[model samples]
Target chain A: MFRSLLFVPGNNPSMLQNADIFMSDAIIFDLEDSVNLDEKDNARNLVETYLLTTKELPKAVVLRINPVNSDLVDDDLKLLQTRKIDYLLLPKANKISLFVLDKILKKIENKIELKPTKVICLIEETKSVIDIYELAKHERVEALMLGAEDLTSELEINRTTEGKELLYSRSRIIYAAISNKLIPIDTPFTDIDNQDGLIQDCKNALNLGMKAKTAIHPSQLETINEIFSPSQKAIKWAEAVLKKAKELNKGAFQFEGKMIDRPVLEKAKKIIEKAKLFELM
Target chain B: MWQAGSKESNDCLITLKKSDKTKIKIDSIVGHLFHNQILNAVKDTLKSDNINNVEVLVEDKGALDYTIRARLKVAIKRMMKDV
Candidate 1:
């Protein structure tokens, strides 16, 4: 249901205060890259305090903590011990890091008598791309995100708006996410000023099976949400497919030269659910 | 005391230095309209944290009261953590 996740710098108090007003499906309070090294503690304190004091936040609140090897992950997880955060965005995620994080989360959950927090793994490095299948198998993994900025930097390649270089990686991410029933989230379009470029990028991601996208600026949220929402034509097609499948009561059938089966029905159901959630119905 | 917070645009950067004389000095730069509102909130947070002797300088960029309070609280907490 998270079509657009808006990232607000954790250290920016003004932005953090007005975070809920943005029209994003979720708000990510970022404590990693966007924050300065000296201000990590400051950002953590600010985010923790806000979560503790705020009466009611409008959308789901996700906290993007520092990387696993940064020696700050423990403190970041500690904030979740008492707070009611929706998800944890683990940057530079890998199999071992996810395993270690899962253990830590379990221990914290047991100690504090709290529910387990869902996690979104950020695949940022080439090495992580290799182990995505293994990483996605973890029980707590709810989504897989492609961090193209870091991946391109790690691979020592120039990034292009066409995204030809990331095709393989995007496909691998989609495969891992889908095979494991996790949501696939695309990377942010870095150029904030170019709306046309953003739309094209979103279309590319949509074709590759990404259900949601990340937003570095609030301005991109509307476009991302709109692009990811199910269209009226799509909803009607899905509804027709479901009705035809139910009427036939067959395992597989032909309709308009396309095969309809359990998998197609499942996909159609998800589309209808998303359309309803988007109020397209 | 130790300095904390950022001076980024639209953020309140609070620099707190410990002082030997048991006195609290306040200085700030904010939008002309909410100057007093931010000032009172910062001073009240300092008192609540029992920060009696410190030099506080605030470089605010149109921040609200809660923001000012959050920044000052972090600065004070970092100072206390060091002590």
Candidate 2:
């Protein structure tokens, strides 16, 4: 249900305090990359305290821990054992990483009597993109997030404004996620000031079947939410198709010179359902 | 001396020093209303950590119980590491 997941630096008190007020569907309190090596302990303590003490929370709370190979991963998991985190955004994720994380989570769940925190595998490395489907189908994985910036660096290519370099990886992730019934999250648009570019990027991702997108800044949430939600034109078409189907009361019929069948009707129903879910109906 | 946290809004800067007797000083924007609550947070954290002799100075900018406790915990850890 997340159209936008905003990353908030874990060590910033002001951002952590105001995380829930943002319009993003989820808050990703980032402990890796955003926090420096010296501030890792500080960030971990801050996030733990905030999550434990805050009475009100956003719809979803995701903690982006360091990679599985890092020493900080164990401490990060141990600290949040008693807290209510919805997802763990595992960076540099691969089959081995997922397996290791799954085992650790199982141990923590068994010991603390806590529910399993779903995982969102971050596909950034070239090796991961090659085995995206296996990572998506992992039992603990609920989503697959494309990390285009890291991927481009690994590919030894320059990422462009048009995102031509990311098309292959993006499509692979989307297909893998969709096949596994997991959410596919597009990468954040790096240029915050370029709203037009952001819109186009989101549209391209959506058209390719990405279910959601991550945002580095709060300002991008509005555009991402709007772009991902069911459009008014689609809703209207769905409603009309359903109305005609009801009137005709047949297995297949002609509507506006196009044949209407069960698949079309089901697609229309899904659109209407999504529109209702997003409160656009 | 060991310190953690910052002067940012909704955060508290905690400084710790080795001392013969435990002393906690709290300076907060919301001290007038939450002075005792802030004091309790410091005392509770110190007690839980079994810290008997340390000088704790909390410079708070409207931090909640959790922020104060967390800052204090980090400071205590740093102080203990040096010990």
For each candidate, the alpha-carbon lDDT, in order, equals: 0.85, 0.90
List model 1 lDDT by residue over A1-281, tens digit each.
Answer: 68999889888887788888998889989999998888888888788777877776847989998887778888888789546688999998998788888888889999998888899999999989999999889889899999999999988998788989999999999999999999999999999999999999999999999999999999998899989999888899999999999899999999889998899999899999999887889
Q: What digit string (tens of lDDT, one per residue) describes model 2 on residues A77-133?
A: 966664679999999999899999998889989888888789999999999999998
Cα shift from native, residue A231, model 1 (Å): 0.8
- Chain B TM-score of candidate number 1: 0.79
Off by over 4 Å in 2: B29-36
Q: Best by DockQ, which number?
A: 2
Give the C-alpha lDDT of model 2: 0.90
List-wise, what DockQ does each model earn? 0.49, 0.76
Deviation from truth (RMSD, Å), model 1: 2.9
Give the clashing pairs for model 1: none
Candidate 1 Cα misplacement greater than 4 A, ranges: A240-264, B7-9, B19-50, B55-59
Chain A alone, TM-score per model: 0.92, 0.95
